[model samples]
Structures are given as structure tokens and as C-alpha cells.
Target: MRPSSDRQAPGGGPRDFAAAEWTKLRSLRSTWALLALGTVLTVLVSLLFCALIGPEFRRADSAQRRALDPVGLTFTGLQFGQVPLVILAVMAVGNEYGTGMIRTSLAAIPRRGALLTAKLAVLGATGAVWGLLTGAVALTAGSTVLGASVPLHTDAVRALAGAGAYTGLLAVLAAALTFMVRRSLTALGVLLPFLFVVSGALAATPQLRSLARLLPDRAGLRLTQVHQDAGDLSPAAGGGVLLLWAAVAATGSYVALRRQDC
Candidate 1:
């Protein structure tokens, strides 16, 4: 019988590239730092919202209180914290381009598609873990301070799970955008404001609210709300829309990576 070593296999497939990408991400101090910052900011901002809102909520009329959603409040910190997460995801691709190390990376891997896929895999996993953690923290802290609680049997479970998916998908989209832009700052400049500021503003406007809700952040964040908003889609639908955006962005990025020179 032939030895295992004698058998030939693909040397630099997606799996191998993914492993290499994971190792590269793990080796970066900035990666760890940004992740930590995102997590910490999420928790702190959640706590702050609780501290401020809890008191006002306690004083509000029953009519006003009836409209408030505890789960929505829990996730308020994510709005701010997600900024850092996006930065981290974009930087995974952005750093290489900025430092002119993309040439070196491409020289070693040669397959741009595989490299891009590997980075997405690593970022997806990282974002999911942190998103879940941040969601749980926000939920607990907000409930404690606001004295607002939701039963486990309700949509609370879906909300929590959605939080994880939302973050992962958002990060994946950011990575794809970074690949297309080839500059961390440029990607950040576009993504952060749109997701954080512009999306929210548009969603708040009477004229554009309907169209704006279709944006990735607006659609994705809806899933994290324990109670449904008047105009919001179902959690499953919202998640699907977010998934669609990520898929499109990834496809576009793959095409750009394959066609463009490093």
C-alpha cells in the first residue's frame, strides 16, 4: 500500500488559506485590542443607558411605559460598540493594503478568492462570539437597572440569537467592503457613518423611513429587539435581508479581488 505522504492533495485550498488567515489574525495585537475595545464599549454603553433611562422610565406614565421595549434598550450599546467591530473587520483587509503588505500576501497565497474567503471565515467567527457576549451583557445589565425583564419563552431567545447573527453578518459585509475599497480608512469612512448615523437618520425621517429600513444595519438590528416595532419586519425576515446584503457584498468583493492586481 502507498503511504499517506505519497498521496497528493491540494496544497493551498480554501481550508489551508483559512487556517493561515486565522493564524495571521490571532498574531495581531491590534486585532485583539480592537475586539476588546468593542466588547468593553458595548458593556459600558449599555450600563450608561440603563443608568440614565432607568430613572426616567421609573417616572414615566403607564402610556409612555407601555410603548417601551426592554430588549431594545438592552441593545442600545451595540449601536455605539459596533463602530469598533466594523473597524476591526475592515482592518483585517485594510492593514495589508495600507502597509503595501497585500503584495506580499498575494505573492504567498496567489489565489485572491481563497485569501478573501479565509479572512471572511475568521472575521465571521470572531464577530459572532463577541456579538453574543455583548448581547448577553447588555440584556442582563439593562434588565437589572431598568427592572425590565422578558420571559425566556418569549421572543427573547430569538432576539439574543439574532444579535449574534447580526454582528457576524455585519463584520462579513465590512470585510467585503474593505476588500473592494483596499483602504481601511476609506471603508471605515463609508461604512461607519452609513450604519450608525445615516441609517438611523433616514429611518427616523417620515419620507425615507420605509426605504431606509432596508439598509443592512436597520434591517439587522430589528432582529435584536425583543418586541416588534410598528414598521419592522419579522426577525426571520430581517435576518434574511441582512444575509442577502452580506452575500451580495461578498460576491462583489470576490470579483474585485480576482480581477484587480494587488
Candidate 2:
């Protein structure tokens, strides 16, 4: 008889693993709920901001008018909306550990790297799709409220794509971090506060602004902005920074998973 450790379970190929992960993900009610919440919040907040833009633009001086970023304004809700996605990502990996399902998963897949890759692929795709949907709806709603046509120019398309990539990268980062910590609450406790409070505070402080801009959330969001402020990174550069962070976290998770017992 062949050794059990060397045996490949039925349906253990990469594509099969991805399909299994997708099935598990889609079966979770929380996944849809969080995605829906994120979409609603993004569009509503965008509409609210767009509604105020007219009055603000009227009150603005020449410089302020020039500084107004309609494209950026359309995505104003991302800060608030991204929280649910982050929670969703954390829960995706963390739940398995919490429920002691990781062992079963390990037994079925055996290859830790393939299992993690499958999960990340499903997560990345889901996040990207949700992000694109939210971005498109938010942009349309904001444009309607502002009495303007939705911009379908190159920059606009780039911003939309950026939003999708940003959300996907964030999901990957959150999932990798959760895998490393092995607990949903612990990951959320760190991620929520850092993304909302700490990163913002650091960005606001002149002394820490440079350092803050390098953080994953701050850097990633730059991609969704059509206008660049003084000292702000270009959209490509910002995306690269975010990608680097996600890559590092993922690598760390892979290493940690290998070192630890399920």
C-alpha cells in the first residue's frame, strides 16, 4: 500500500481545490451579507457626497474649485465600505481555524501551499468583482446626483480598475494576515483599528505622513483617486506599494502555515 502522506486525495488538483473553495465561500451567508452591505454603503455615501458637491463648489474660491476632484469624490465611501470586506476576508480564513475545519481541509488537500493558493484565488476574484460593482454603482449614483454624465474616459476607466484591484489586494492581505494570526477576532482587532484610526492619524500628522503613505491601506487607496496631491504617489506607484505589502503578507502566511501544525 502507498504511504498515506504521499497519496493525493481525489479531486485534489489546483482547479478542483479552487472550485471547492469557491463552493465553500458561496455557501456562507455572511459572504453575501457583507458584500451587499459594502456595496450599499459605498453607493449611499457617494450619493451623499455628490449631493453636497454642488453647494460646496458654488461656495469655493477659484483654487478650491480647481482642487475639487469629482472622480475622487465618487469613491468617498470606500473608506467606510471597505471595512465589511476586510471582515469578510478575515472570517474566510479564520473561520476554518475557529471551527477546527483546517485539519479536515489539510487532510483533503495535503499540500498547504495549494490550499492557500486556492483560497486566495477565490478571495481575490470575489473581492475584485464586488469592488468593481461597488465602484461602478457608486460612480453612476454620484454622477446622477451631481447632474453629470458618468465619465467613461481613460482616467475614469483606470480609476475603476484601480478600485477593483485595490479591494482584491486588500482581501488578499486580510486573508493572509488572518491565516498568520489564526484568529478572526485578533486579525480584526488589529486591522480595523489600524485601517480606520491609526493609519489615518499617522497620515494626518506631518511628521508621520511619509511613513503613513507607505502603509497598505493608505498606499492602496491612491489608485482610486484621479487627482494626485502634492507629494502623493502616482497611482501605479501606490498600487505597487500595496502589492508589495500583500505579497509579503502572503509569503509570511505560507511560511507560518508550513511551520505550524494544523
Best by TM-score: 2
lDDT of 2: 0.89
The Cα local distance difference test for each model comes to 0.84, 0.89
Q: What tens-digit string does per-residue lDDT give for candidate 1 at 1-262?
A: 7555724854667877788888888898988898788888887887888788887777778766655766677787887889889988999889989999889888878877777888898898888888998888778877788876543645666777888999999999999999999998899999978987899799888999888878998889888875566887877788899999999999999999999876
For candidate 1, what is the lDDT?
0.84
Residue 75 miss distance in model 1 (angstroms): 1.0
Tell me how far the alpha carbon of residue 157 in candidate 2 is from the true structure, in angstroms, after superposition. Answer: 0.7
Error of 1 at 48 (Å): 2.2
So what's the TM-score on candidate 1? 0.88
Question: In candidate 2, residue 247 scores what lDDT?
Answer: 98
In model 2, which runs have C-alpha deviations exceeding 4 angstroms? 1-11, 58-66
